[model samples]
Each structure stands twice: as C-alpha cells, then as structure tokens.
Target: MPDKYEAELPDEVHELLAAADKDREIRLTRAATAENLKFLELVRSKVKDVPLFWAVTLLSHPELGQAASSTSDKEVFKYLTDVELVQDAHDPREYEIVFHFKENPYFTNTELRKKYSLPNGTKPAPADGTITDEMRAFEAIDLEPSSMTIEWKADNDLIAKHPRKLNSEDDEIIDGDIGSFFHFFTEKSDIMSLGGTIIDVLAEPLEFFANDPSGFDSDFDEEDEEDEGSIDLGDDDDEDEPQRKKQKKERCCHP
Candidate 1:
C-alpha cells in the first residue's frame, strides 16, 4: 500500500486486514501441506531413487547442507526417504517436521519427527464476554520446549563419531565445526531457533534444489535484453469512470 493510503486507513481497519491476512496464511499453509503430501506419494511411486534424490537435494542446497558436516553425515542422509513440514490446520504456529527413513544400519527407528507448538494470544472480545484473566494468564505461560531423540544404532551415533575438534590455542572448534548434523536433535536450549533452519528447507525444497550448492542457477541468463518500447493510447475521459463505478459498487455491497 502507498504511504498516503496507509495514513488514510483507520487503526480498526488495519487490525481487520491483519486478521484477514493471518486467516489467509493458514489456508495457504494447509494447501501447501496437501500438495507436498501428494508430491511425496508421487515421488515414492515414480522416482527411481528416492534416497539418492533426497540426499542430493539436501546436499545441493548451500545452507541446508551445512547440517551434514562429515562424509558419515552425508552417508546417513542417503537413508532418508522423505522430509516434510506439516503445519496445524487451525494453528499456523504449531507444526511438525517429519523425516521418513528406510531401514538402515544407522538408526533403528524409521521415522524421526520434531513437533512444535508456539502459543498464540487469546482473541480480543467484548467487555461482557466470558473470558477471564486467569484464562488469559494460563494461555500466556510458555509451553514446554520441543525435542526429538534420534535412536542411533550401537556404534553408529553420528554426534559421537564426529566430535568437535577444538583449536589448541583457544579451545574453540577450528573453522566453527559444529560436529555432525545429528547435534540438531541433541540441542536442548534453543531447538526452535535451530528448527527454523530445517523448516526453511522443508517449506520449499524445490527452490533450494534449483539454486543448488552455491545458490546459483546455471541456466539463468542475466544479460538478456528487455523490450523497453511502450505504445501510448490517447487518453479517454471514460477510462476512470469504469474504475470509479467498480469501487462504488464494492463499497455499497460491502458496507
């Protein structure tokens, strides 16, 4: 919106617009989840190599691939069949990330999932409403932190296999090596902050795959010429009349 138009709109209207946008976002998240699930089915049936495709897709992306710090970490990724972010239909903030895995020597479990539920404040209501202060206070309390345990096979724990090699002088990990990617599951303090990184990749895997290792598209041509020519039709007095009528009708119908 233009600054002038924003200044003209009342605060109540802005609040209503924000609420509408949040509702629309929930709908969009559900739609995307359905489409992604459908694509997963297609991938299971049609894709010749599910494990390899997933491994490469993750390793290809520069940011996401950082999770796999070692060759062993990359090797474990080959067992992954599918990874997806499933958002709650009613609550957009509440979601889970699931990784479907084939039976492998690395882990006993087939699926590893991390669920999250960030609180959203209570809805505003009339003064006479039944909502109470105690209810609001209960809702405001911070929920328990989310965590996932990766059941690694004996002698196959990735985090243990690849310990952080520290610098001799400062006792800090050389080159900021955070050990194996499996540490993501072990993070107890700030899983939400760490989950954001994985969530980003799950949200749009295709976009990350398209950019690949260095966030560059080889097929793109930046030098392509754009047509600058424009044809101007002579002004007509009736041009604004139709738009005005449309606006008037919308206001009449909505109001």
Candidate 2:
C-alpha cells in the first residue's frame, strides 16, 4: 500500500511537500527560540532573589541530581549562581552551556562552559545513504560528546576526593566515584542520552523551582510564612529577621 501511494505521487509533489514541511519547521524553531530567550532573561533577573535557586532545581530532579549524590557535589553546587545556554552566532545547530559560579572554596574560575556541535555541522547519512530534509534540521541530530576542564582549588578537586577502584592486572583505575556532579564539568556527558530535558529545564526553570520540596526556606520564621508577600529573598524590609524562602516542590525531568 505504501509503495502504491509513492508511485501515485509525482516526484515534484514530494519535493513541494518536503519544502513546505522544512519551511514550517524553520518557522516553529524561530518562534520557540525567541520565546526561550525571553524566558531565560526573566530567569536571570529573578533567580538571584531566590538563593540556591539553581541548586535546588537540580537536586529536586531525581535524574539530574544523580551525579551530585555525594556531599561534596552538593556543597560545590551551592555556589552555582547561574546556568546559561549560548547559541553560536554563526551556526544555529551549535551552542554552549555556561555555568556561572560565585566566589567559593571549590574553584577559582567564575564560569565553566561546554560547547556542543555536530561533526562538520551536519548529520551523517543513514545506513541506506538517504538524508531527509527533516534530518537536516538542527533538532534532528545528537550533539557530539564534549568535555571541559575545571580549575579546581588545591585539595578541592571533588572528582578526585572520591576513591576509585583499580584493575588488578595492569593496575589501571577503573571507572568509579565519577558520579560527582563536578564530573559534569570534567567529563563528557552523553548529551544524546540527556535529550531535551536539560534544555527544557533551562528554558522553564521556574516550573522546576516550584517543584523543589527541600528548598532553602528552613531559615524563615513561621510568622513570615503566614504573609506570602513577606517571603521575598530580595526584600530588605526586615533587616534583623531572616528572609522568608520561596516555596519549592519535587519534580523530575529525566531524559
């Protein structure tokens, strides 16, 4: 039945349909990209007011926090001020993930980034040697795996803090204790496995922030909680009182 339909449709008709589909996809991508930029700007503006906003967001997600299960990983994460995704000015398919950190005992650098791109800036042909216009879309290909180096402070290398087991034969170190979230900076993450979850979380961080149950609100007084407006982290109304922390719930965005 599929072959019969293909035979009935002229090659020109197929070409026209493919062109229309590509145009529609480009339009949708552009619209989504614009909205994402706006959302990110909003997050940047409001996130500082909410202390540990990004840390709580990551920990609340079971899949995302899997790498930060260790105590040191959590501690280092406390300094993570922001996470920004920057698109390549030239190649729409390429982008970088930049992590902004405040002055901390962990590292000296203020920012760490990881760039992702497809080989030759294009997806490879399938086994059948056919590449559809759909395949040419930026969203269609998985980014090649990449890694970045973290300038760890003396004795502050969290990835090395955890002990690793060695093979008995050649005495080579086997994969171990690399689950530290710090490894996210030092190691090559299989972004393909991560899929769109990372992007989704960054694009809509507030939704994830709302899901952090163990948020940084324990310092707030019970009376402050009574007044919803009193829970502003940025407000300096009560200089002596502890600022009321925002509410958070548990939510996951595993790929």
- In model 1, the number of clashes is 0
TM-score of 1: 0.56
TM-scores for every candidate against the unseen true structure: 0.56, 0.64
Model 2: per-residue Cα lDDT at residue 34: 68
Global Cα lDDT for candidate 2:
0.57
lDDT per residue, candidate 2, 126-175, as tens digits? 44534356354546346655678888899977667754454566534476
Measured by TM-score, the strongest candidate is: 2
The C-alpha stretches of model 1 lying farther than 4 A from their native spots are 1-8, 48-51, 84-86, 119-145, 163-175, 189-194, 206-211, 215-255
lDDT of 1 at 114: 67
Give the whole-model CA lDDT for all candidates, comma-separated.
0.51, 0.57
Q: Number of the top candidate by lDDT?
A: 2
* Backbone clashes in model 1, listed as residue pairs: none
